[model samples]
Structures are given as C-alpha cells and as structure tokens.
Target: MLKLLSTTLLLSSFIYANNVSEKVEDFLDDKFMENPRLKSVDVTVSDVVPLKQLAGWNAYIVDVEAYLKAQPKRLIKQRMIWFSDGRIITKELTDMQGGESLTDLVKPPFKDEYYKKENLLFGNPDAKHKVAIFSDPLCPFCKGFVPGALDYMKKDPKKFAVYYYHFPLERLHPASVHLVKAAAAAELQGDKNVIEKLYHVQINPQERDVKKILKAFNKAVGTKLTPKDLNTPAVIKQVNRDLDIANAVMVGGTPTIYLDGKVDNTKKKYLKVQ
Candidate 1:
C-alpha cells in the first residue's frame, strides 16, 4: 500500500508541473514576446513552486530560462498569481489591511539599502515616508521629476524624505557620467540643490564636452568645480555605488521612484504638481 501511494504521488506531481509549464509557455508566446525574433527563440520554463495563499490569491514562483537560436541565453525569475476567480496575474502582488495596502509587508523585488544616510538627498533625515529615485540627469523626464520630488518633500519636511541615486545612460548620453560625478561631488560639498542645478543647467549629454558642462554646472550650483573635483575617490565611489544600486534594482530607465520601498504604481499620489 505504501509503495502504491508513493508512485501515485510522484505521477501527480509530474502532471502538475507539466501543466503549469505549458500554461506559462503559452502565455509568454501569446502575450510577452512581441518581437518576431524573440518569439522564434526557444524558451524553457521550470521550477514552478506554489508559495502560499494570501487573501483571495495563490502565489506561485517560477524560473524562466530562454535561449536564442544563435545568441546568448538568459534567465528571469517571476512571481505569478492564481486568483480564486480563475485569473492569473503576472509581475507584482500585494495585500490589504484596514482598508489600505500593507505596503510595508510587501517583499520588494530587489534588496537595496536605499534609506542609508549617505543616499539621502533632501528633506528631514528622520521622516517616516521614504522616497528613492534612480535617475539620469540627461533624461528629459528626470529633469522635471527629480527636482519636482525634492520640491514636494520640501513642502512637507516632517512627512517625507528623499534619496536620490545617479543612473547615467552612457550609451545614449555620453556626458551623463561626468554630470553624475559632479552631482555626487556637489552632494559631498553640502550643496542641497545638486539635482535641481543639474536639471536646470540643460547641458546636452551627447555633446561630451566635459569642460563646458563643468563650467555650466559651476555657474548653476555656485561651485567652482574643476574636472579634478569630479574624479576624487569619494565622488567616483558614490557614483559607482549609485550605478551598482541601480543595476541591482534592474532600473530600466530614469526617474524610477520607490515610495516606502515599493514601486509607486500611482504617479499622481507622489508626483502630482502641487
């Protein structure tokens, strides 16, 4: 009787795994891979594990491995949900408590020390509401968003704190590296408006004219920053640290904001012009 039970359990597990894998593959082929080249690529989905039931949903974690016919392969870890109403949601999940989202309990997709003192940009250091922004100085969206966030915190100093990190898109904006380093140096110098100055100066990132941009940076922020000031160990280290954090968080573009450690889905809540 024990041997027969073991055989039946193993078969059941195998069938369950196969069915989930097929479903995921079909979902990806139909909805995810939009590019023709990507659709043609081979995909392998495995390691489907049901995590837990929360509220009215069941959480499942899966590892998807994809291989291009003649290119490099990649692996992506995904969190999927199975709703009680026969709906499957991919990407993020959340829980509610007391008629509000329990954002503090939500496990962040990435582990980052964003609230460190060194990363703080503006507002009261002890404010309970923490906002972290990973942004590129040359990104048009960031020019308005980063400074706007700082301004918002300035209004409610007791309620919010802001941490800003540099993520220079060197491929698109070659001069961004220098500007980011300058921002780091300015932060070191206790210049509170480093981000605002950088956005206001409006130097073309593609120009790559370090001296011209440095001159503009100095004029905008009231700092006599030479090229040497940007290359100091502390400045470069801070910039590299920002880059490391951005990469770890998988930030795809500028002005990615996290409100209290979770990605803020509603921009209007935090970013609306006041």
Candidate 2:
C-alpha cells in the first residue's frame, strides 16, 4: 500500500507538471508503455470524449471505484494456485497466459442468430433449433462426417445454432488429443476452413516435426499458422480445455453427434438423435 501511494504521487506530479505543455503531454503518452505499475494498478480513466478529440488526453478523471475493485482478483480470474502457492495451478489450461480469459474465444456469450460466417453453426442461437456435436479428431468417422453435419447450414440456412464439444477416447486412440488440440488451435485462429483438414491430415501414424504439422495443418484448411504460434500459452491452454471437456462428457466414441442439445448415449448420428 505504501509503495502504491508513493508511485501514485510520483505519477500525479508528472501529469500535473505537463498540464501546460503540449509537447510534454505527448512525451508522457508515448512513455505510458514504460509504466511498470500499469499491470499491477487497478485503475481506470473515464470520460466521454468527442471522436475528433479522443486522441488528446489530460481531460479524464481517475475512477476510484474501479481502482478499488482492481485490488482483488475475481473468482474466475483467480485461476492459479500452484502447490497451494508453489506453482501456477490451473484446471482448464496450464501453459496459457489467458487460458481462462479465452472463454469468449471458445464460446462467446452472444452467439450468432443466422448461420455464423466467422463461427461454426448448428442449433439456432435464436430460434427453434439446438444442436450439439460429440467429436474426436483422431476418429476417422468423425473426420469424415462431422464437417458435413456443420455444412448443413448450406442447405438449411438459418433457424438453428450449433455447439461443438470435444470427445477424446484416450483408450482407443491415444494420440487423438493432440490432433484435437491442433484443430482447436486452428479454429481459434479463425481458420475454420482448415481445422477439419488438420484433423484429417494428422490422423496418420507417421511422426513428424510439430512445426511442420502446424504449417501443413494450417495450409490444408485454408489457414496460415506460424510455428511461433503453436508454442503460445493460449493455444496450449485451449487444447487442455478440450481434453478436460472431453473427460467431463465421457464420450466413448468419435463422431458421436448430438442434436438439439441433448446428450443421448444410444443415438450417435445427427438425424438419428433428432
């Protein structure tokens, strides 16, 4: 608390000193990135600025309430608890920077009403249809049919929505999980065109470079993935989340399609579940 107050005072004086100088204001704005306390400070600046003058600063007020709220982490935001504080412990993803934060990436709060051009479609997020999918990338059957089921949007257009859930049968296909991760990474990259393609290409038993796999996987589905991106904490965490979701659902087989949001064990195909 003492440290925070001291730093706050220093920053305040800096801002106050620049109140009369345009050049000084520009210098501080450029130096804003160098503030070491930025990530730790729970602070906000609020003002309704005109579009034309939005870029100019020194007019906003410090939101003290917002600052007070920033002191404690949200429950969901409290994602790590390593060895009870020894290491960063995470349930959804271990290697990602904002693994939990990416919940909006895996499934957004407000989904599309019509067929989503950017996102996958199944049951109507708005209307009479609700759909679910049980899929594993290592399954040949899933690789062959799951994409077709998603393509139904071409025939039916709107009036329904779709949700995809991971179902990895570790017993039957031991390597399926990573393949699913690669696909999830692609899906996250907004290259739906190549996600399924990655699954299909990687199903083979041949071992190869992880980078090469990511590259080939991206190109096949009409997406481009850099080798650098594969190592990102976000992608790794997402892949781990897929594994967790699969374990939660206990899907025994691949391509176990569900329709209208119901998880029917006896029904495996889309229309069959319907």
Candidate 3:
C-alpha cells in the first residue's frame, strides 16, 4: 500500500507539471505579438514548486526559461506565479524578511539604508508600514497605480509611510528621462507634489514636447522648472541611485512596490485597503 501511495503521488506531480507547461505555452502563444522584437518565443517551464498558502489561495511560483528569437536570438530567465484557481501573476517575487520561499530559496536582501528620510516622497516618516514605489513618470500603469497607492496610504496615516523611486524606461517612453529628472530637481526645490502631478497629467504620445511638459509641470506643481534644472549633478545622481537599487532586485517594470522592504507579490495586500 505504501508503494502504491508513493507511485500515485509521483504521477500526480507529473500531471500537475504537464498542465503548467501547457498553460505557459498557451500564454506565450497568445501574447506573442505583444513584444515587437520577438520573432518567436520558446518558453520552458523548468520547475513548478508549491509556495506558501497565500491569503487562502494555493499559490506557486513557476520557473520559466525562455529563448527570444529576436535579432540576436537571446535567452532570458523569468519567474511566474500560478494559483490553484487558475490565476497567474507574471511578476517577480522577493521576500526581504529573510524567510524561506516555496522553492527553499531566500529572497534578495533589501537594505533599510535605501529608504532614507530624504528619499521619502509621501506618508508619515514614523509610520509602521514602510512602502516604497519604483515608478516611471510616463508609464500609464504608473499613472493609475502610483496614485492608487498614495490614496490608500492616506486612509491610514499612522500605519503607512511611502517612499518614491524613479525608474524611467527610456526605451519605451522617450520623454521619461526628462520627466524623472525634473521630478528629482523639483524634490530638491521642496516641490512635494511634483511626482503626483506628473502622474495625473494627460500625455499625448504624438506631441512629446519637452517644453510642453515643462509648462505642465510648472502649472501643476507651482514650479517654473526648465530643461537646465534636469541636468544638475544632484538630480542625475539621485536618478542613478534609484536605477541601481532597481537593478539589484531584478525589477523589469514600473510601479514595483515593496512593503517594509519585501516585494509585495500579492498586490492585493497593498492595493486593497481594509
């Protein structure tokens, strides 16, 4: 009976892996054209390990190694999450508290030094919940998520303190570098709402004029910022620091949020305010 039980378990594991593999392939096939550079995408689900029970949902983070048949035909590594109820999260996950993950791997170490007082853009400095937002000024998702996060924190001032970091995706949003640098410069000048206003502004893709953006920045944040302000040594250094921290944690997208230094993979924890 013991032998039979072991065989059953092995078979179940195999079947589960097979299903996950198929799902990943289906996802890639459907989203093939999402990236213009991809002539073809070949993905392999190397492993599917069960993770902690996440808020009553059985969750697992899958390891995917993909080959992008682009101009140079490059290979890439990615981690994706899968839920027992057919839900999938394609973002990276990290645990800053030194806890063991589902795969028995420790999350990347997060330094508290990174969240200095001067670096904070919103919320009470002494608040218990320290949230950090790494975002791009021109990202559409950042527009929605950044404001949403701030609004959520406002509800409980005593419990939450948020930090802001600029991560401009220049390849995608050409005007982002200027906007981010301007935000850093505005911060230096004590313009507290510069980043928030930038997020709220409506940007037309065809007319990505720097002068127009500067005018809007001045109007929204009550500061007459010019192109020269964005080129200051201090502003450049601050932006570089943000980029370095982001790269260490393998952040590939905008609006990456960390609550108390850990990557909040279950975004429901941060987004849904109870």
Per TM-score, what order, best first? Answer: 1, 3, 2
Q: Rate the local accuracy (lDDT) of all candidates.
A: 0.67, 0.46, 0.68
**lDDT per residue (tens digit) for residues 180-273 in model 2:** 5566667776664554455556434343456655655655666566656655787777655544444333333666544454454444444542
Error of 2 at 223 (Å): 3.4
Error of 2 at 270 (Å): 3.9
Candidate closest to the true structure, highest lDDT: 3
Candidates' TM-scores?
A: 0.61, 0.46, 0.59
TM-score of 1: 0.61
> How far out, in Å, is residue 249 in model 1?
1.4
lDDT of 1 by residue, 164-228 (tens): 88888889988888888888898899887777778877677787888998987888778888999
Candidate 3, residues 212-255: lDDT per residue as tens digits? 87776677677788988988899988888887777555566877
Q: What is the lDDT of candidate 3?
A: 0.68
Off by over 4 Å in 2: 1-123, 168-175, 199-203, 206-208, 265-269, 272-274
| Candidate 2 global lDDT | 0.46
Best by TM-score: 1
TM-score of 3: 0.59
- The alpha-carbon deviation from the true structure for residue 162 of candidate 2, after best TM-score superposition, in angstroms, is 1.5
Distance from true position, residue 248, model 1, in Å? 1.6
- Looking at model 1, the pairs that clash are none
